[model samples]
Target: MWISWMIIAVMVGIECVEAGLNTLTKVAMTSGMSDFVFVVYSNSLALLFLLPSTLIYHRIFLLGLLSCTAQILLYTGIGFSSPTVASAMTGLIPAFTFVLALITRMEKLDLKVKSSQAKSIGTIVSIVGAYIVIFYQGPPIMFSQSLPILHSPSESPLSNWIIGGFLLATSSFVISVLYIVQTWIIKDYPAEMVVTLIARVFVAILSAIIALIVESDPKAWTLRPDMELVTIVYSAFLMVTIRSVIHAWACRTKGPVFVTTFRPLGMVFAVFMGVTFLKDTLHVGSVIGAIIIALGLYSVMWGKAKEVEIIENSFICRINSSSEEVPLLQNKSIDV
Candidate 1:
């Protein structure tokens, strides 16, 4: 019971960290920090921390490539949209991973089982909630009259929202694929830290190259001594290194779907961050969608727990049956 609670707490903590990251990154970008440059700098700084203990494998490059691509997409989306949108889009990950896992045969589907049925229902519900958040904007709710320092214009253009939503959705899908591949790699290597380090190294190199090309002005790479520097360091230490290591460990222990199950939790955290720090207007549709997403998240988590319990009970029954058979054979041999 304690272990289950610990897992839940840790997952919640990770989501909080992710929401904070998005908030900070958005603030820094609003201060004129190039998204591409930010990715390169933070990742490069992370490489320095990870370099102390490093092992290389050629196949791990794919992991790095995917990571870089996803980060670029996510940050770019945040530039165009709000952190709330980015967090909301993450709710799609479990649904995406569930489908990918089934396709890859990593997960089994048996509609007859209540657990599987719950998971299926939860996936559909989650996707519906996500789209509702995307398509519906009923009314904006303001918490305070004062505008935040980091807040952008009163309203972002609709085009930007559409583009950002598309990019964020794409990023989530890529992450789902990465989770599947990472799980496969971990099964063979079984070294979470080393795997993560190798992947980060690749991300740093690739992102640096892309940043150089996209940000032609040399001044764009220069970090200011203010929030720009702070965001980079925070992102490097907490997000790039610590978050990646924790996630890799979680993915090793629990399946990819389990790791992604907590994504909706980030929406709650993001809403808090946006309202307090960013002073982002809360929309009725967003509130409704987030609540629905949370419900779906709970349903999926319950289904996963039930499935685990069923597997464990079945294993215990098999062991008991074998033990009983052993005693019966011993009695038959003695009688003979």
Candidate 2:
């Protein structure tokens, strides 16, 4: 039970880190860093940062390959799609993880119970709330000239929103697979730092090669002494190595469902951060959507907590019942 609480606490920390990751990455990308190039640099730098771990427990290479593939697919999909599509698709992760977990027996789906029902409903509510945030951008109640400075000088107008949406949705699904795969792979490796390092190394190599082939302009890879450098260092060291190790630990301790339930929190952070930092306007839709997302996060947490309590109680009951019968059986054996 105490362990469960610890997992929850750690998950909150992970979510906070993820929020910063999103914000920082956005700021860097907005500064004219190509997404593919950024991916390669961050992953590569992360590899360098975590090379020590790789030296200690390096074995499997296939897992690293899958990790790289997933990363490539994810960023590529996001490049093609809009952020709204990406978020909406990400909302599908809990559902996808739930289903995948059940199939792999990583999660038990006892739908007859109230806890299970709450989980199911929580996932749905979270997705709906996310869509609300993404779809309904009402009038700006607060405009910021300083923060929420959303400047996309790089992106051109998308002619095919549908295509972009599909791409992003696909990326979201790939992310779900990535989660499950990571969970499975880590079980065998059992070294979170080593696992993260190995994956990052593989991903870095692949991303760099791809970047070279696709990006003809040599100037694209140029590292400026601005947000780009900051993002690269921060993402490599903090985001990849440290943050990923923590997240992988949480995933191993809890289940993927628990890790994914915080997806909605990203929107919460984005809304607030946009208004405060990016000089963006706060809309009514954002307010309402934030509320809904909050509710959904609560529901998931409640359901998981309830489920944990039930399991602990059952375990205690078994131990007590076994102890009680132990003396009785001993007396009978002595008489015999």
1-336, model 2: which lDDT tens digit per residue?
Answer: 678777767766655565566566666666677777888888888877788665875654665665566556545544554333454556777777788888888887778998988888888888888788778888879976643334431343565455656665665666667778878877776788887877777778878888888888889999999988887887788777787787678778776788888776766766676567666667898889878877888888898889888989999999999999999999999999
RMSD of 2: 2.8
Q: lDDT tens digits, residues 262-331, model 1?
A: 8877877887777777666677887887788787877887888899899899999999999989988999
Native RMSD of candidate 1 (Å): 2.2
> After best superposition, candidate 1 residue 184: deviation in angstroms?
0.9
Could you tell me every candidate's TM-score relative to the true structure? 0.92, 0.89
Identify the runs in model 1 with alpha carbons over 4 angstroms from their true place.
53-59, 130-142, 146-154, 283-286
